[model samples]
Target: MHKSFSLQMGDKTLELGPKPLVMGILNATPDSFSDGGDHNHVADAVAQATRMVEAGADIIDVGGESTRPGANEVGAQVELDRVMPVLDALQEAKIGKPVSIDTYKAVVGHQAIQAGATIINDVWGFQRDPELADVAAHYNTPSILMHWDPNRDTSKDIVSEMKRYFNKSVQIAEDAGLIKGQILLDPGFGFGKNYEENFTLLNRIDEICALGYPVLVGFSRKSSLGKLLGVEPKERVAATGATTLLAYTKGAHIFRVHDVRENYDALQVAHATIYGPPPAKDI
Candidate 1:
């Protein structure tokens, strides 16, 4: 069984537990691998966030820059321009869900927190910019440190290397004053891993869960799924839901996904089967 964690984000608390939490992806970039240009404007982004929350998302993850392979890296100011307005609008809308800023840049992460983001999701695993951990620690925000190494040697044992990378990231967070509860680890399913390596990581993800931090997995519309199923990005919702069920059984605690309702439904069924149905609520 997976462990539960209470992530304190300002006045909001996310109870990530045995019935994994869903983090809806809200990319405000024009060139993300999937769902780009769909919500670049402030109003559109807010609407999508609202929809995700209503669809049962426990958190909304907002990203300004696309991290797809070979995507051009934008300057800090450009990224800030794209993200700050959306953050402001979401905060004003009172979305009633925690917002996580998906950024590896320290400047963007810092300002995003000040603008009302409660979580720092660093795709670079606090290894890109040293100050990003400091920013997360400064605000005492829950940080998702994702494993990403473009130069990772594929011949070596991938899970072992990932464990080492996570150890380093955990040390960095601790050095920056982040406690164990404020940190979460993501295996970065698609990033830096070849098709075979992605599957291997998933197969052995229980080893990662044994590290004792909540594991967040993101396999939504990934090219790996397309390669496996010969479908386009938008058509891979079923494939994504398959991974959600598999990963949840492997002890993952959070799922970062684009199709919130579909993934949420999949999790509900899995949870009911494994843990029994939750106590019914009153009308």
Candidate 2:
């Protein structure tokens, strides 16, 4: 049987698991490390999302703010302006996939859900804004809670720290009335983790996956990969693919990525090679 988790986002139902879910990255900010201002315009954003869907992206993660280390924060209105048009255009175009809002502000989360987004991919893990959990609960939608620390640095033993963070975030989500299956957790690959620490976490991701909620891994073009391959952000596609395979073996069910088609194609081959075709019993 396929491991399944149900996420009710507005009028859509996302059945995630068994097979890996690929979330394509779409940033509307002008300063994101990759594909930032490229998708700021409504037409461009819609086109890019459409292309990702065609490329096998299960979800398109739309973010208005740049979360790369040392990125300057934008106000909620700016974030809203950056994301709303894309959300509107995507829905208007009938993209036939869930649009996850990459945000932490409660107002933006609420507005994004109201504007047709179904998931909140909060990097702060709902700790930055407590109301974020409430927004997810209110919409009966799911939110992606990433692991974080008090100092917000992954310089130490981040695996243990990530477990504790996931525990707390899960409690908060449940307390806010999100059902058991409506919460998703991410290991937050490079959010605060250093080069080695990021790999350590990825290697031991099953520790987080054991928590029961679906695990989302965002290793796309992360600096850790760059540092490992000694390449720049633009050259991390192969590195990202390697990590995607490693993460799946470690029980990651969702992958947040930049190069969707490459990662998707990589996963297809990896899955078939490892698990063989779907059971002949199914046919």
Candidate 3:
């Protein structure tokens, strides 16, 4: 069985377990690999977030910078300018879900938490800016650390390398005062892995979950899916749902995705099939 966690995010308590949780991806940047410029405006982003929540998203992850391979990196000020408004607007709109800031910069993470983001999702797994861990620790928020190292030799066992990378990330978090419950691990689906290595990582993801932290997988609309299905990012919802089911069976605790309702429906069916139907509600 997958491990469960109860994370305290400001006034809210996020429960991750039993059934998988869906974290809707809200990329406020204009250059994300998918959905770029889709929610660049504050009103559009808020509207999309509300739709995701209504569609059963458990969390909303707001990212200002594009971390896609070969995408130009934006500075901290630029990222803050792009993201702060959305964070503020989401809080003001009261989306009723913990908002996660997707960034690898310490400064941006710091200000984002102050701007009302309750979770810190570092794509670089604190390797890019170790100080980001400190920010999460200081705010006492849950942090999702994803394994990413483009320079690593992919010829080696990718799972082993990922574990080693996560070991360092966990140490950084712990050293920065973050406890086990405040941490989540991601396999970094397409970030640093080659085509085969990506599949190998997904196949061996249970090993990462075996490390004792809730595993969050974000294979939604990734290029890997595109390459496999010979489709564009916008057409990969079904493919993304397929990975969601596979990862769910493999003990993954959270799924970060672009398409919320499809994945939510997929998880509901899968959970019901494995664990029996959920308790019915009164009319």
Best by lDDT: 1
Cα-lDDT of candidate 1: 0.93
- Write one digit per residue (lDDT tens) for candidate 2, span 117-139: 98899998888898999999988
Q: Judge candidate 2 against the unseen true structure and give its global Cα lDDT, from 0 to 1.
A: 0.86
Model 1: per-residue Cα lDDT over 19-120, one tens digit each: 779999999999999898999999999999999999999899999999998899999999999999999999899999888999999999999999999999
TM-score of 1: 0.97
Off by over 4 Å in 2: 1-3, 150-156, 278-283
The number of clashing residue pairs in each candidate reads: 0, 0, 0
Q: Report the lDDT of model 2 for residue 71.
A: 88
lDDT of model 2 at position 153 = 46
**TM-score for each of the candidates:** 0.97, 0.94, 0.97
- Lowest summed lDDT over 10 consecutive residues: which window, candidate 2? 148-157
**lDDT by residue for model 3 over 124-212, one digit each (tens)?**
88888999988888999899999998787667788888888999999999999988889999999998787877787788888888998
The list of candidate 3 runs beyond 4 A from truth reads 280-283
Residue 68's lDDT in candidate 2: 83
